[model samples]
Target chain A: MANLTTKLGRLQMKNPVMTASGTFGYGTEYSDFMDLSRIGGIIVKGTTLRERQGNQYPRMAETASGMLNAVGLQNKGVNYFIEHIYPTIKDLDTNVIVNVSGSEIDDYVKTAEIINELDKIPGIELNISCPNVKEGGMAFGVSCAAAAKVVSAVRKVYDKELIVKLSPNVTDIAEIAKAVEDAGADSISLINTLLGMAINSKTRKPMLSTITGGLSGPAVKPIALRMVWQVTHAVKVPVVGLGGIMNATDAIEFMLAGATAIQVGTANFIDPAISEKIVEGINDYLDTNNFSSVTEIIGALEI
Target chain B: MKKFILDLQITHKVQLNKQNVLLKLTSKDLLPEILPGQFAEIRVDKSPTTFLRRPISINFVDIAQNELWLLVQIVGEGTKRMAEMNPGDLLNAIIPLGNTFTIPTDKNAKVVLIGGGVGVAPLYMFGEKLNRMGYKCVFLLGARSQSDLLLLNEFEKIGEVYTTTEDGSHGEKGYVTQHSLLYNPDFNYIYTCGPTPMMKAVASYAAKNEIFCEVSLENMMGCGIGACLCCVTDTTEGNLCVCTEGPVFNINKLKWQI
Candidate 1:
């Protein structure tokens, strides 16, 4: 049987089916519809030091087959996550990965150190690709030097498996991916929301409070796939791909493009249970192909 | 997660005039407890232009038959496609979403119901529960024109019904507030769902009269529940999510746009 299990450094996943950060809010939100235990792991909502109120009205706008968001990490901070979100989710059957976002290097290190102290947290996903904020957002992930700096800084205190999420809004994503890889990142996730905009013709103003927002959903799948392929070849670290993946076919497409795992975003806005569907679809695809596990299919595509 | 295709069979489709379609649906299993002012995010797949799910207020819920009803208008591609659905076609729907109308109490009694446009549908469900419990009910309705009036007869069958239309084409010949304020009777608690303007008007009137009123807000939502934070209502308690904190809110608890 083709074994489906994969590892990010020391941690092992039953399957390579994971939920992306920002899109999957702490995993418990979707528990009402499906069992949380079935998913491989969940990279929960982004967190910071203080409570984040996020951007204003029209946080999301629809494009052809995709949507844009400027929800500037609106969440109760790390302390609140420890007290509120973690207690409930930590007991759940799945791996709980915290998606950490920050303005400074300490914010990143402190967040990672706090999660390391927690009992059930599996990993820390550093989000250096948020274009909506004014400072230290995607700037870190876009520049290889900054990416390596943040990666090394957080790596010093993280203690556990550290995944550096790469920003697609960059001149060369593969360079930053390699930088994080060299900085001791266990894995790399690609293509956070792309910077995009919308306009209200009558008012002649931008639709979102911020003139620009991050784009996600099915529209960016092709671009995200391209990045995943590029970064997968550039770095030895495992790659988790996301950006508008709505179904199992989309997930498979990423796997073919060199991503070892896949994350479901935007689709959560449309169908809350799509991840389960994607999981089922993957299992079905594996079973029918007579492949013993998902590992055989990971980067199985022939050039 | 049980990934069963929710075979949402359309039991009945009534085209209300030309603007709206009332789609009555039934499924295999019993639905969860759905309250007034709460909505269902329906996957509007009837046409290509309307692929995203349309968030429709829960107009009515028939618990006995495991069926639900939605009063949707042709505001966009979603509602327009929903209008064309027929019997036997399945429309994937997620129900009992968002916060529902806060019924008077843990122990119920006097309750007043209010409606405007398709918003009136949810009131019917609350009215049904109230009437069965023998709570004294008063209904205040608002509409653009007499013809635009929906479910008035159904509401009248449950309680005393009052109405107002902008063109003087119906009962009160004015806004619902005009009539509600004029005959401002003692309501132990009130429930309302309607256009934002109408609900705001009702909420303010209720606030001024010192009446305990719960108004359901309508916001453009991607998910009927609280993942997107798409549907939010600013309150005295900061930015409270309309999807969770309420699609329904107490008039006193709300911070109006004014």
Candidate 2:
């Protein structure tokens, strides 16, 4: 049997397949469909210090092979999560990570400080790449200095594995990845949704209420792969590849391109069991190829 | 509250009109307990444009025979593909989703159901449950023409059925809002699911006459579960997940202009 266990800084997961933040609403939502314990990790939705109602109606629009969303981090704040959501999911036999977001650095730090008190939460995927929110989401993500500042501030309070999620809307993604690493980031996950727009040509109005939103799904996979490969080489910290991964083949490709782990995002909207299926497929592929451990294939691209 | 993902076999497909089809599917496995107003999400395979599961309401369920009915309209590519399926074909569905309509406390109360276009799809199950429970049911359905009005006989088997066609080719010569049966709001309760204009009108009339009322919303959704924040309906309590919190909501909770 191949060893599928992998690590993100101090955090260790049984496998390399984890659901991306915001896509998997806590770990409990999919418990009826698949075994939550079989998956490597679960990154809950984008949580903030205070309850955010998010954007207005028509938050999602479907495009060819992809979708745009402006759901503006509509979570009920971290306090609700710790009090209500945590007790329900903490007992699940899997790594439950929180995806923390904020409109200000203080919001980010305070949220992390509360999560640090929880023993069940293994890590947090610091979200500096949310494109839908007006304030701190993509603002800190696009610039090296802002990215480093958020990471540094949160790193001071959050003792767990800190995975800095980077935005794809920057001029050079690798530069931003390196900045977070220097800011004491334990790991990096890249290619958060690319900003895109769609117009209802008949009505001559924008499809999403935010006018422009983050684009995700198979349409963004190729670009996500390129960025993951670049950032994996640019920083010494482990890189988690995401953006538009749909299936096991896509997950394996990300791992081969140098990602130690891969997160499934929009694909969950299509198939709730996709993350579990990808885990099974990765094991099957490793066995078929005569590989002894899953880590042996990381960054093993022949080119 | 129990949910199941099952591969159900298509037993029959009855085309209601040029636009709608009634699909009867049976499962060999013991079906999970389901209530009226809940829906199922069916995956559309082999279609290029449809990558997401289409959410459809449960129209009828014959628990004795393990039969489930889905009323589908050819709204887009996804529904178009569902309409073309043949009997004996297998369809994977996630079912018993969302909350059921609140059954009135007074079983003897007079109740009315209003549906607009394909929005009337969920009323069959709602009417069936009410009829079997001995509640008085009055259905007011709206469509474009005589052929556009769906499942009149099925609803007739359970309650008093009324319909209005845009072309006036059916029971009433105007919209459902103008139906004579609706003039008196002395009913104990009213339940509605239909076009926004019709629902707003019904909510307005019900509110004015002090009739307790509820309306089902047809918001465009992704992941019929609450995970995706795509399907949201604003209420007095704030924005709630239409998929989990409701597809059916009391009129008082809704922040509609009426």
Candidate 3:
């Protein structure tokens, strides 16, 4: 078998198939469908300093080959995660990463500090790109200055690998990636979700309660690949790519586009056992192409 | 209950009406134990416009035939594609999802199952289970017209069926709540599933009469599991996922205005 080990700064993955945040719950949710250890990493739901009730009833809308969600980081705060959720996931064999979000800088720093104490968690993916929340989600991510400020504040208290997740809603994602890297981000993961909306012609109303939400699925693949390529060339830090990664081919496309690692998002909703299949698919591709290691394809784009 | 993602081959397809189709599916292995109010997320393949799996309620399970039935309504692209499937087509589905309805302990307790449109699907399975358990079942089904009413013969085999159609072509000339049988509903328990407004009216009537009631909610969902917190209902406890916490919930737990 071809070697599938992947490295992003201090964080090492057995393979490059990580589940995007908000899609995969705590690793326990999918324990019945597939082996959780088969995944490279599991980024738990976005946790905040305070509990959030999230948006109203209709928070989801299905579009052509994609879906929109305005589930504004509905979580029970980080403390509940440490007390209730941590113990269950701490013993999982794969890398367990927490995706942290906040309304203010202090909230991000405090949540990161608390998670930093957890022995099992290898890193934190700072989510500055959640489009659903009203306060500091995509607000901080759209601006390079705000993105750097939040990353730098969390860097002071967080000692582990700090992976800043970049939002695609901005004009120049590469500039934001560079700013976060300069502010002490160990790695950068990109193309969180593109902001989009869906409308019902008959009802003459928006499909989602929030009118607009973050779009993820196969529809956003091309945009994610373009952003990953641009940011990888502009920044020095390793990049984790995602957005409509449904299979191993999609995962390899991200690698060829210069993403050091890749994540699978909306496809998880369609097929629960997708990540494991993707891991196998990647291995099959490596063996067929006679590549010795999975890392050989990173930034191997001919053009 | 344990959930399974199985490739079930369609054994039979019956077009109940222009808007509805009854698909009977079976696997090589014995079908898993499924409760009355639970649902299945069926994957719609080859449909370009459909992205997510469609969540359809379990209409019935014929144990002797080792089959599971799904009564689908052609409301959108996903379901329209489901209606077009042939007998030999393989449909992948995640089965036994969500919570089940409460089965009363007292066999003599007066129970009423109310449904409207394709909302009557799950209640058919529920009524059958209640009848097999030695409880007399009363079903109050509603539709836009006589033709829109589905599974009348099947429901009649298991319970005393009453219906209402807007066009006065069925039993009553008005909505299910307007049926004369509800004038003095001496029911001990009521279970309903239909349009939101219809279910709300049922909840209101049940609350006023101090009858224990439960209603099934059909909310837009992302993932049928607890992961995608998309299909949430405002309840007394907080925003709970309708997929995991319930497709069925007690009226008292709901935050309905009634």
Chain B alone: TM-score in each candidate? 0.90, 0.97, 0.99
What DockQ results for candidate 3? 0.87
Q: Residue by residue across A1-303, what tens digits does model 1's lDDT show?
A: 346577756567877778888777778778777777877889988888777777766676666677767777878889999998888888887778998888887888888888889979878889999888777778888888888999899899888878888889888888888889999899998889889998978889987888998888777888999999898989898899898788888898888888888889878867888888888888888888898878777788789
Per residue, candidate 3 scores C-alpha lDDT tens digits across A178-216 of 999999999999889899999999999999999999999
User: How do the residues B1-258 of candidate 3 rate in per-residue lDDT, one tens digit apiece?
Assistant: 888899999999999999999999999999999999999998999454898999999999999999999999999989999999999999999998999999997999999999999999999999999999999999999999999999999999999999999999989999999999899979999999999999999999999999999999999889999999999999998899999999999999999897
Model 1 ranges off by over 4 Å: A201-205, B1-5, B46-48, B105-111, B180-185
TM-score of each: 0.93, 0.98, 0.99
Task: Please provide, for model 1 over B1-258, each residue's C-alpha lDDT reduced to its tens digit, 9 standing for 90 to 100.
Answer: 112335578999987778878888998786667776767788877343454567788778888778888888887667877787788888887776766666566345556787888888778887877777677788878889988888777788888888899998898888887884447456677788888888887787777777788887776666655776655666776666676777777777677862
Worst 10 residues of 1 chain B by lDDT: B1-10
Better model by DockQ, 1 or 2?
2
Give the best candidate by DockQ.
3
DockQ of each: 0.34, 0.69, 0.87
True contacts kept of each: 0.18, 0.55, 0.85
TM-score quality measure for candidate 2: 0.98
Q: Rate the local accuracy (lDDT) of all candidates.
A: 0.79, 0.90, 0.94
Candidate 1 lDDT for residue A27: 82
What are the clashing pairs of model 2?
none
Query: Which residue ranges in model 3 land beyond 4 Å of their true spot?
Result: none
